[model samples]
Target: MASPAAAAPSTRSVRLQIPRAHRGLRDGIEAWLEAERDQIVLWAPVAFGGGIAIWFLLPDARGWLSAMLSCVAVGLGGMATGTGGRLARILAIGGLLCAGGIALVWWRADRVAAPVLARPVVVAFTATVERVEPLAARDRVRLTLLPDAGAGLPRRVRVNLATGDAPVGAGEGARIGLRARLMPPPAAAVPGAHDFARVAWFAGIGATGRGFAPVTVIAPGAGQGGLRTRLTAHITSRLDGSRGGIAAALATGDEGAIASVDSEAMRRAGLAHLLSVSGLHITAVVAATMLLVLRLLALSPWLAIRLRLPLVAAAAGALAAIGYTLLTGSQVPTIRSCVASLLVLVALTMGREAMTLRLVAAGAMIVLLAWPEALVGASFQLSFAAIAAIVALHEHPAVQDWFAPREEGWGLRLVRGLGSLLLTGLVVEAALMPIAVYHFHKAGLYGAAANIVAIPLTTFVVMPLDAAALLFDTVGLGAPLWWLTDLALQILLGLAHLVANAPGASVALPSMPVAAFGTMVAGGLWLALWRTRVRWFGWLPLAVGASWAVLTPAPDLLVTGDGRHLAVRVDGGLALLRDRAGDYTRTMLAENGGIDGEPALLADQAAARCTPDACAVDVRAEGRAWRVLATRSGYPVAWRTLVAACRSADIVVSERRLPRGCIPRWLKLDAAMLRTTGGVAVTFAGGRVRTVRTPGDRHPWLVPATVMPFRVARFDGGREVRRRALQRRRD
Candidate 1:
């Protein structure tokens, strides 16, 4: 190097030598970061939810203090928006939010901690009803009970009772006596099934049970039979059949009167949200109240001149929204709507943009701060997702032009409004598809069309008429109103039935992994939250997640928690390992296998060897024929026959343990092994096995068998107490 400066490449020259692809990538990333700079705060709720999810999975919060400290440090590091580059600032704020979430969830858990039922028990007790919820079943009703003070019972318990067995006059806040069979909330029967026990624990419900004997109304005192209960009763009394149930649900949010068939139809048509009294109902009530306020104020010239009409209307709307939220059971969705509505009202009052991503995020943050656990609930997730999507759509420049109001005649305006409704419905259904499938294992394909009709029918016609009926009932001028309400409700039901029964109306999907669900959600948020051209990149991950979900294979074999039931994949669906399974067991097996229809009985399936006590079937798994054997009668099998079958079969499943010589070629699953595992699902695609209870993964809800929270309690059938206790201890 004659001259060091000349020999070495100049810094500018080196920078210029960068590959085109690399430079393009860099430029793209910078643009993305720049676009997302302001949107960082919008992601705060997502980070917080991630922390809550971690707590649910691990349930270990020993390091929460450190997380909190980190949050403080991160906050300090990113105190100013321009403290660092956009990326660094975003990372710092995200870290703070994540840490805050962890701290909040840990603290909330400790605060709400209560003892859960450790075992089944029988007790006769008197309790007061805090609230009542109607079940889908005709004769059954769910009651939230408040146990007597100083009693050796939980502070709160949820129990079911046969309506026919209870006092006919029983309503909210009535003291009742009953002899019930109380049991711990149940765990999942399959590996990925819903965990009732976990839900119960978070909800502070110590036990769940059904009344084994008739319930007596100790004192029909109704300290809680307030307006909601009275309104529900009045609605039901005026309307009969399914109409009454729909009317009551729309008015008071209690769906007990709706028959199972009608409810199922609504679910299949994707109109179940209407009965849930969510944002749609809340907005309708608020908007109506505001319009009425404006007109009434206009009538009074003096008041109109003195008072700010819009401001007064907003205040009245807020009050109406709050009252409606309380009237309609105050479910998670209703509360979320109330929060969002309150935010919008505040914004309007302050002369700010009322509908924006910031408003949605603020509402979500409020809910999460109050009830962090709600983040995991379906209602919360769906509500926020829909609102965010709608707002984002409106924010789009192209969409804005399409939806922009123009000076036009009433006819043109009506057509434009209808077009907007239809388009919005389609967008919402598309956005909600993944979530709906994940939770229900099905998606309503024609939901958009069905909702376009159902929403208007319910919101514009049904609810208004029902309100009018209730208002005019005090003056005996409500019969026509009640009849009009019923007519609209019946039309809505008819639409539900029509849409649900159509061919391919809903598509059943395979059970998807949590990873896929998270991926879809991330992609959706990306597309909806960002305004830059890069937002379309969200589709890449969305497509990947959707493919993953649709391609997930069903388990090849399944065993119940108690090893009393077994199933194997068949040609069309699944074939039961035993024919003597009950309805509940059959339904669980079918659902776990991703089969919409009932499973074929092993006795009925072709090419199956069967007996009263055992059945042998040859099925294809992993592109190979594998013979499976299952015992049905729960009796000790003949050693010679069992050994012969074991030698020939690839898998052997029996209620009793096999002899030492009885070895299957692949696996032997017996009751002794299943007891520890809880339930087992085997997939031959990659020879994977999943269990309901993994070894060493114990929690307060899924306690180990060898370790009892108290004693290894069991129901001793009418045995003498002392003798039974002594026998139990000795055993």
Candidate 2:
């Protein structure tokens, strides 16, 4: 038998091995739990289903469906890997097969439906105005058509019309006939430009129309009887003459009352968002309403308890927010914010943790389901991105540390406020830069600075006063509020002018290449979602964008088409020709092609300048050099010598073509034409030519065959050299 000591050592080793095995098993179980935690549940699955449905319903939906289904397959694979053994293999194979089946069904449905869906047709119909606004120079109106007019497409149409003599209101229904052109909304304007068509499609618009010519309102009757419309009209009508117009515009999205010039000034000043009812505005209004209601409830403890005061107040605030959203015409972005806020509120009321990511996803799902096209809109993209970024930033450990421990004293508070503003401005500006460049071809370099001053003013002073004015107007004492609003407007306008005038304030950037823009967006998303040092790599796009802006070429020519003057690029120098004597032509020429250099006058007698071989003349160059006949009183010898040197010049460079003299090739006096024979001719109405032709075609060669009226010649080594009168001496 083995010794007792030897047996003891072996038993100890076995016991140690058992504990290690147990520990490994526990670790594996914890990981499995974590993975399960990450899995989609509840609303996530619903959203996933909606995405799948959209993929199935839209054209080219099979690809999108395949991509989404692949994610499911990936999850299954990940699960199987952790399970190991025979069970894992079986699970993987089964999961893949299930995914394949679903994909096949989607594909089959799409193929079958593709032929059955009729290509939308253009037809005349009556439509009710859902939303209307001015875009560029045209009026863009979204209208819902009558359902049973036998137009089997959809209930809505986006109309781009000339804002005619009639003033249109949102709730008004019109009995006007117009042609509806039906087509799929474009994906984007210039690759990365927001796709409005996709947005319109999801909003239930199958067609777009132009004009109110065939469109006439049936009556000024209340079109859609909604609480939102009623509130909008009420607020707008009451705040009509008040400076609270901007406030009402911001609160209710009634921009019609806001003057165009004022609106533009606010935008340039970086206070444009204040005028729109966005997430920030909605949150503020809700918070304010909740506080007021809570304070009232707190005053009566018994009533508060009986009414479930907090919950009741929250519900009221929710209703108010919804009404506000509708009053603001319920734009996709506004509605998205409303839904997102409501989700957060409901989560709070139910005592469930409302994760930022979850709320964002829910909001996205709502928007996509309602208007699948909104996924491509700028307002949708920027609003969501800004919100998501703000949420992420607030959650960041570094940011939390800096802000969580409140600063004491006024000086410290001011420092904190300024720091917060700077950080927020930087993040939002960075987030929106790429999209702004893509759409506008210009980036506000000083936008961060503008926001630093404007955001605080707009939020703290402008919005509050406007809101107060609206409230006061509802009663009858609106004058004070209106005056304050006017003062705020003036301050805003001043800030806009100051910022707009700043050096390098607005830099015109070249439109980004589609691939580059897509890459940048992907990089940005990675930076936001991924937590690592690699996030810094997102700056690569900024670098690339800067380089592109620096390298963009200038336009070849800039013309005003007013027929005042012509600026021609001749031999790398700009030549100015004024049709009439005035400073306008000279000033315009100086600014042509955005060149801000000294004006070199070619026609003014006192400032006339030219190259050694060329001369300036008051008379225009008309006919071909060989055919220009000099007047009898001036340059007779030079004229005879010029005509003798050439015989075939039959062209006339003039403002008006003369019927006499073989009807020569008439070149317009103000036009710049590049002749194949290596010479350029500027002409006048009297058939005068100031031709600059070099010895060879490479240098500027003149072909002479018909006739030359004025010339001076010199013979050097058997080669005849001729110099024509580029200038006409007055008789």
Candidate No. with top TM-score? 1
Listed in order, each prediction's TM-score against the native is: 0.88, 0.59
lDDT of 1 by residue, 35-134 (tens): 7777767888887777676656653334456556666677667655553556556667777787778778777766766666556777777788887765
Best by lDDT: 1
Clash count per candidate = 0, 21
The window of 10 residues in a row where model 1 has the poorest summed lDDT is: 704-713
Tens digits of per-residue lDDT, candidate 2, 357-420, equal: 5587678666765554355456777787777677767767898788765749988878887887
In model 1, pairs of residues that clash are none
* Model 2 CA deviation exceeding 4 Å by range: 1-76, 79-155, 158-164, 167-171, 174-196, 206-220, 223-245, 257-265, 304-308, 347-358, 532-731
Give model 1 RMSD, 1 decimal.
5.2
For all candidates in order, the CA lDDT equals: 0.79, 0.51
